[model samples]
Target: MKKLKIGLLINPVAGLGGSVALKGSDGENIQQQAIQLGATPQAEEKALRALQHVVDYKNKVEFYTVSGQMGEHICQKLQFSHSIVHTTSGKTSASDTEHAINEFENIDLDIIVFAGGDGTARNVTKALNKDIPVLGIPAGCKIHSGVYSVTPSAAGKLLQKLLTGEMLSVSYADVMDIDESSFRQGIVKTKRYGELPVPMDLTYIQAVKQGGIEHDELVLADICADILENMEDDTLYLIGSGATTKSLMDELQLDSTLLGIDAVYQENLIGKDLTALQIEELVADYPKTKLIVSPIGGQGHLFGRGNQQLSAKTLAAIGKNNTIVVSTKSKLKALQGRPLIIDVLDQNVAKSYKGLIKITTGYHDSVLYSITD
Candidate 1:
């Protein structure tokens, strides 16, 4: 196999700004406090997890990294030979990230792989856009960009396919960046720019985004508020897509996987991106869990659109009685009543979801979207 000259960059403090994080930025004294409070710097973990995607290809490829955390330490641990992006300092920060991204702009490497969140992707967009094909290992909290994989291991699995030529055509996606300082104060703001190179056709990965909601997002907000009024403490609401799911997540003052399946009861996510075994484990103990999913605006199908999160195991685990699909009249009308697909990892599990399901639209209201062979 031809060795690919892959570039690697790790944003050591990417996940520092999450809600539980005392310091949203690793540069802040808040990071130390968060560590004391038992929170790991998830950026490094995300970077390492992304690195794990290439573990099997260790002998077939080499990597180039920046100094310190962005470079040798991570590369050494992964045991992949690599080059270093010459940095002015021994350590790296957001500035170093920009520098490293800029450095790779003209390099002839096969692909540049970085472990970070939207911020890192945003910086790369500002620096270059020549199909310099890049992949992201999500290490930050608000991963609203389309460039990230569903999980660290999924990123690795995708890379494995790419390396073995098992993947499909690559595409460019928009990048987004959010102001961390303001978000912590309950004000979320995001802006988007044009497309950048990213692997496409991976049902399990993302490349599109929903930045800070503007007037365009309000319609969905109204829908979620309606869902919230009926969501009691016992109901395990599974909010899917459309304006409705986003609305519920925003009003609940809680987070949703947005595009992924979240096993939510009252207000907590019992499991996220839950696998078959994990769903079985959760239902084994708490069988009251229900599913919340919505079909895409135009596409009639529900299961296959970037929602690999609600695996057959999860749907069967939640059962049809507890399964709830949320969509507006306009969205459902657009579907033209096509049967939704239930593609997942396990065909046997998908069979258990056979039956009629209810979709809640508003108070004392619902419509039926059925499952068929």
Candidate 2:
């Protein structure tokens, strides 16, 4: 078989703002602020994790990437032979990502694998316009896009299957994004930017986020009713994002951060749109705490997609047993046999959550779901 040619690109500052609670690293100002806030670049490390899975195929693949932080640094560290097709500055920008995509389009690559979030996905979509197949490594704060693999290692494994012709088809996946300003204000205004041609393997690639699920209101009400009935006095509850969990806050007649983390204590809102530090502080203050989270509609991710405010430290402090997973039965059925995934960026914390966990689906109903790292 002929060697597969792959184009790789990394947005070095993709996920810098996530842990700092900046919401996203979209503009230069946010990037600078995130760095000042002690946020470190994570895209390169995530890209390395994805690449590590494909290391055995080094001799069977031809690699092309940009110079320096864009891609060369990681490729060199992994000792992978790749030609530098483009050069970028120490600090890259959206234009650099677009330029790199354009360069990749001309390389006759079998696939272009990128490491970043929704913004990076949008840039690639705008550049290629669905002319080439691309995959994401999920290294950003906002990953509403469906082009990303379920995990970094999953990306590598999927690419290996694609190269070997095990995965033979592609499907168009939505590239979604929301305004950062509005997002920080606890408002979720997601827009469908475009679509990218992605591999159709559901085991590896995530489906586009499903909207218009308001029809599940009755079920959501039941779930909230259960949570409300179980509320304990003098205990802190960390409410996570998503419409389902927001229903719980709605039932309590409290304001909800639709896409951010909020804290409720003694049936009252204590904090809204909190940062990781703020959450840790709250956890320290209220040792009796429980985290109420709802998984992404089709992805089955209880954390690490949009709610970076709930950092690994916060989850560890909350304890796995203290975490409550809420979802509609239809949502769980959509998984089609995939385990609920956890990507806290801390392997120890993620691995700590093994075996089956309970998910509250209705007022008096629950299901045992397997948790995976």
Candidate 3:
């Protein structure tokens, strides 16, 4: 059997701003500030998770990657047979990512697996231009792009399948991203930069994010009524990001972060756009708390897609029973019978909430939904 050639790339700074509430780490200033805010590099850890799945197949594959944090470090750590095709500075940039891809163009690679978010996807698409198939490990904060796998381990599984010829055929997936400036200000402005050739298996790869539907105003009103009626005094409520949840905040006449987490107490917006640390601090002051979250449209993700602010520690503290999920019937229908996905970065945490859970659809209206990782 001929060994399959695979190219690896990692954006070391990718997703560094997620926990600290910076929205993204696109620029040097933002990356530095995120580190100063106590945010750590997550892309390397996420990349290692994906690569671990393919470790047993090392003898059947040859890996090519850039030097240092871009790729070589993890390859060596995992003892994978890899060669450093390009050298990168200790500090990496988008130009380094593009240059690495340009170098890979001379090699005959079966696939190029990258660990990063939408920005990394855009850079890869620009360099390769669909010249080869690519896959993404979800390591960024705002993953509105379709290029990423549903989870890090799933990326490894998909790569294994592709290399063994178990999966075939490729489809164009949208590479989308949001403006960080507007995103940090509670505004969501996404643009489709380009598309990349991804595997056709829908079970492994995520679909492009869908825009908010014009749900019936009355339904939203009913949901708000139910939430307000159930509000408990002296207890904190962590509001997750989404259009549906924002409507609930709007009904209460309280300020809300459209694409960021917020804290509420007695129906008052106490904290707008909070980080994980900020949430922990508030949770300490108000020991009793409930989390209000909504699913991502088309993707069916209840957590870890765009709401990293609700870290595993926060969720564990909030408890699953204390969590309330709200979504319009139309949104659930669009899921096409798929279970709500969870990628909280900790498998044990994601597995804690299995089986059916209730989703608050309207006033005194709820539906049982299955939760999965």
Candidate 4:
């Protein structure tokens, strides 16, 4: 086993409070709207969770993190030692994250780990590309990029594998981001930058961008409808819209959240409005709870964005083993050769969901179709 030296960086406040409770990230405009929504900063808590996962492997890896959100106190909490960048104070800032990446330039390390959304990925890329392998423990609300694993636990598992030499350590994960403000209006626009490496055992996360054209949604309607019909009763369905899932909701005579996760069961509207708690409550009663959702049109997100309402709690409660995706052949073709991406709050659930996912649509003469990645 090649015990590799590692560094840790966390964007503590990256995607703390999103649409569910807080208004979410402030856009080109200031974060005023987010502030007004009684939005509290969740970066510390989120970063803490992501860091906890990293610290689990403390005996095997050394830490080279900046202070504060970048890697200060959290490392201390786990009783792990760390190295700080010379130019930086023990204090960390957004610029500190920039500093952390640059500092990696002078240091010799095997891999780097960080916690944040797509914005953090873009920042890290400015410093390390394939030259240094990095892994993300999902912490941000809008983690629409491919550089992260499905969840934090999965990240821990992958890291453990790398340290133990159980898995090959040569490959890359996609680099991507999302538009924070536009995401609030129920839009998730993403773009690809490049790739980073890690062992391939983990579920590869991808970045989801904004939908391309609204005009083609009508064509997607029938496709969404067929998947809706395929949904079993009493199962928890987390539907996404790009015309496909929305049209499916229209056909079921049920109104999809359109931009959130709406719950349906047993021919009854169980929860018109849902949050992570409500979803957990519903799924607990039905152990067989299944999540029926779809990828964003052009961005091709298997989760997040159009389904942020599904929160990590809900995804965990429903279990990724029970999750489902729906997409049209045309939509799948648009992805080129790239696989779909889904970034949610829960790190463990994200990791459990790997391998080819089965998509549900309709049949002949119907917008129904089946697509997989």
Error of 1 at 317 (Å): 17
Specify the poorest-scoring 10-residue window by lDDT in model 4. Answer: 364-373
Scored by TM-score, the top model is 3
Please, what is the whole-model Cα lDDT of each candidate in the order they appear? 0.62, 0.85, 0.87, 0.61
Count of clashing pairs, candidate 1 = 8
Error at 277, model 3, angstroms: 0.4
Tell me the tens digit of each residue's lDDT in model 4 across 115-154: 7777778778776644877887666665656677655545
Clashing pairs in model 2, backbone N/Cα/C closer than 3 A? none
Q: How many angstroms is residue 73 displaced in model 2 relative to the true structure, after the best TM-score fit? A: 1.7
Ranking by TM-score: 3, 2, 4, 1
lDDT value, residue 109 of candidate 1? 78
Candidate 3 Cα outliers beyond 4 Å, as residue runs = none
Please give the range of 10 consecutive residues that has the lowest summed lDDT in model 1: 17-26
Q: Across residues 1-373, which tens digit of lDDT does each residue of candidate 3 receive?
A: 8888988999999888988888898999999999899887889989999999889888888999999999999999999999988897677999999998998888998889999989999899888843788899999988889989988888988888866679578988899998989888766789999888887678888878886455689998898899989999978999978888889889888988788898888888899989889998888788699999999998898988788888888888887899999998888998888889888667777877767889999999999999887
| Best of the candidates, lDDT | 3
Better of 3 and 4 by TM-score: 3
**TM-score for every candidate vs. truth?**
0.59, 0.92, 0.96, 0.63
**Which scores higher on lDDT, 1 or 4?**
1
C-alpha root-mean-square deviation, candidate 4: 6.5
Q: What would the TM-score be for candidate 1 when compared with the true structure?
A: 0.59
Better of 2 and 4 by TM-score: 2
